[model samples]
Target chain A: MTEMLRVENLRVEIKEETILDGLNFSLEEGVHVLLGPNGTGKSTLLGTIMGLHKYKVSGKVYFYGEDITDLTPDQRFKKGIFLAYQLPPAVRGVRLKDILKKILNIDPKKDLPVEIYNYLKSLDLDETFLEREINYGFSGGERKKSEILQLLLAKPKLALLDEPDSGVDIDSLKLIGEALRKIAKESNLLIVTHNLKILDYVVPDSVIVLLDGKFVYKDGLEIIHQIEERGYDYVRRLVYAQNLS
Target chain B: MLKTYLKEIRERALKAKDKPAILGPDIDLEPYMRTIEETPIDDLEKLPDEIKENILYSGITPSENDKAGTYFQINHSVVYEKLQEIYKGKLEIMSIQEALEKYEWLENYYSRLIPPDTDKYTAWAEIKPTGGYFIRVFKGQKVEHPVQSCLYIKEGNISQNVHNIIIVEEGAEVFVTTGCLTHLKDQPGIHIGISEFYVKKGGKLYFTMIHNWSEEFHVRPRTAVLVEEGGVFINNYVTLKPVKSIQSYPTVYVRKGAIARLYSIIYGRKDSYIDLGGRLIFEEEDAKGEIVSRIIANDSSKIYSRSEIIGKAKGTKGFLDCRGILLSKSSQIVAVPILDAQHPESELSHEAAIGPINEEEIEYLTTRGFDKDEAMSTITRGFLSLEIPGLPKVAKEQINYAVAQLEKAGL
Candidate 1:
């Protein structure tokens, strides 16, 4: 199988502090989860992979075997890579329907009858919400659903969701998991979350443990059970043992 | 007020130039200037009813400075002759003096829409020729197309003070588009253009103004619309480029059951300075007003929008919304919305928002395959959408065109 996304020796230093240190990872066309503590650079790795271009990054990022370490977020987007931020900005006076229409160029009178209705129904959002400004005054769960809605609308090849289940409610979280599961069947999914409650709904094909900016272990879903039982002490011990060996 | 304003004009005229031992009468015609200033007031009593009605319908505000009678002579004589030639048969366009001389009683009907001495420029504008436009739409008159006026600065070093008065009688509809433009470069100039609109009950009047001037020019445009009961007035004022400084706030005074909507968008770039906003005053029941403004500033440019809504009458509803988008670090945008209500039963609301474009949102869009510029442009195209209820198809198309260009330019 071909690698969809590959990160080699990725070192990220933000404000003089190295957050991602010589990280190495790759994912095929399926679901992958980066699970770790809050400060383990899970989000940073996603940012670097998504071409955020803020931090000073050293090393290589390859999308489908092509070097994209220097590609901008926009270029990556055109190449079918997408990121769902944990905290999205509120764009006032811009309606959600208008944005969706502009981005997708969907003819609402003819084509949107079923597609839009099903999309909103899947997220349990009412039609009135479509006319309101984008994420303005939206609840935490609503913002997550909005992100999901964009995902469904844009339909990129790779989706890097930074803590997609962080602030979402249980019901919406389930919808998000289901949506992720549905989307991942056709596209690659890399979800970054500190807690694994979201995994209860949509299990990951592989789990990677990130510790102190480095990947300590890469295994199946059962590794998450190990973290649930042992904690960071076990991961740190493995990192120390590997460094000495 | 006119006397005080004229005294100041005289002082400014004295400082204009000094040719030692001037012998050519200094090109000052105080008597003719005084005739231009006071003749309208004097003719109000002597003119026939028909002529008086014509003058009052002309909508000219007489000179404020009773003293620089000489200043009006030095500045207005040439302006009057040129205006007479430009607007000979199609419509009646004149200065306050000529309107007063020709139709004094008519000039007396509705004069002071914007009070003089609100500022120096306004005060000076009140006295300087009061460049007035007299356009009359007969009852049941349907103008096939809109009429346009261009207040152009033809000379390199010149100050233009043009006042316009438009009246569309009952059962008539008229569309007027006026613009302020200049060709001079690196030269200091002042332009004060004021227009008064009176739409009789059941009359429809649409006014559009496009203002673009150079950096060395100080442009002050004060326009007012008085909509009677059952009248409808739509004013679309756009400022594409104001080089140096601009202070223009077109306002509307709607009576009972009238609808007034003003859509203004101002863009400030480079070192431009813009202090622009608008006002809506509702004085009767069932009257409504909406003011929407969008301002963008880049480089070291500064834009300030002050929109005011005064709801004093019952059943009156007014909404003032201002949005500011600042692009550069040095650029500044200050939007202040003030609402004053005397009637508790009236509905009044004001909202103001200022912030940079969200980087995360842009990142999301960019990751979706747009570049940084494309992301901003996409967001900006979204920003220009305002609630333009009952907008004409052509106006909507023009606004769409402007948005497309802005998006293409990456905001």
Candidate 2:
């Protein structure tokens, strides 16, 4: 499989506080799960990879063998890189359909394309939601569903999803998981989540465990069971033991 | 009786001619006192292409298509006036002078809402009343299309003073769009407009005004409205272009079970100084009022946005929202939202927010494939695109057109 994304010696700092230290990872064109505990820099890694300006990134981030560390978020987006924010900001007065029209380059006077309409249906969102301001008063589950809907519409080569399954109800999780499974067939997904319930619908090709801002373990689905049996502390101890040996 | 009323008004105006406004910088009225030549045309096509273009930019259609009537005033005279035959009896659109001369009872409605001695601008308008539109919708008739009116200033150093009156009879409905503009940039001018609006019992009136003035123009519009029992009044105001200074604070009085909604979207550019606001006073039970304003100040512009909702009667409710955006470092926006509950059963609330554009919103848009500039423009457009409740389709379209024009002008 061809490598879709590569991050080398990635170090991120926000306001002089180091979040991600020397994180190195490479992913092929498949579904990958990033498992980590709270405040383990999973979101920072995703934001850094997407070239968000808030993060002070020191290392190089490459997409399909091209360096994109200095590129803006829009430039990275043009290069088929998309990030679904963990907590999307509520933009008042900007309707979701209007932004979708802008992203699709559709005419202002024309209706939204049928494909997006179908996506809305598949996500179990009402068509009237299009007229609502983007996530302004949306529920937690609805916000997650909105993020997934954007992911499905963007269909980027590399999608960095931050906590796509968090704060979602079981019903919405199933809908979002199924949508992700469909999009994973055409795009590469790097999903960050603490819960493994979403794995029931969309199986992961590889599981990467993040500890202390670094990828401490990388394996198949067995790592998920190991962590389920013995919490993230087990993985930390295992990685510490390996470094000591 | 009319002559006596006029004499009394003139005397009162003369006394208040030197009185300064409570807000905004005082303008020296001497420079704009010079008189300019008036051009009155019988046909709309006779208007110069340049002047017509400016009029169109202010959201007035020059062709008069889809309009119930058209009133064009240039300098101190009415250039052209036309009313569609379909609205001949149901609606009336004519010059204020013509209406006053033709109708003996016009004096009762004129200057009744806004007194002539309220301020210097009102005083000036009463003393040298130029041409303005007089529109009235007959009782129980609903005018389908909007009546378009344009107040154009053609010469430099000219003072254009006009008094406008609009009356919506019982159970009547109408929408009026007025565009006030200048002919050229940097042409010093002063416009003092005294407008009085009356909405009868159960009547509805939607008034939308767009201002496109030059950098050397000073505008002071004194407006007042009276909403009778169960009547509705919707006012939409947009001023997107540059002006030397503008200070207006239109007030509305809401009677029993009446509703008043005032929406303003202002974009201040260059060295403009704008102090715009609206006041609503609820006088009877169950009356409701709302004031919403969106202001964007760019360049070195200074804007003061104020809204006041005074609940005086029992069971009256009012809400005031004032939001402003400062696009440049030197730009300043001051938002003042005041709510006064005088009666024990009255309820009033207000919220005011003034700040620069949200960086997070801009970045969020950029992540959706929009460039930084595109993101900023999109966010700015959204900030200014307010969905005013109960606005007529034509009025909303006019407001949207003005906002789009501002975007094209690189606002």
The global C-alpha lDDT for each of the candidates, from Candidate 1 onward, is: 0.68, 0.88
lDDT of 2: 0.88
- List where candidate 2 sits over 4 angstroms from the true fold: none
The residue pairs found clashing in candidate 2 are none
The C-alpha TM-scores of every prediction are 0.71, 0.98
Candidate 1, overall lDDT?
0.68
Q: Model 2, range A30-123, lDDT digits (tens) per residue?
A: 8999988889988888888888888888988989999999999999988998889888888888888877776676787899878988899899
- Please give the range of 10 consecutive residues that has the lowest summed lDDT in model 1 chain A: A105-114
lDDT of 2 at B150: 91
lDDT of 1 by residue, B330-394 (tens): 99998878898979888999888888887777776665555677567667766775557787654
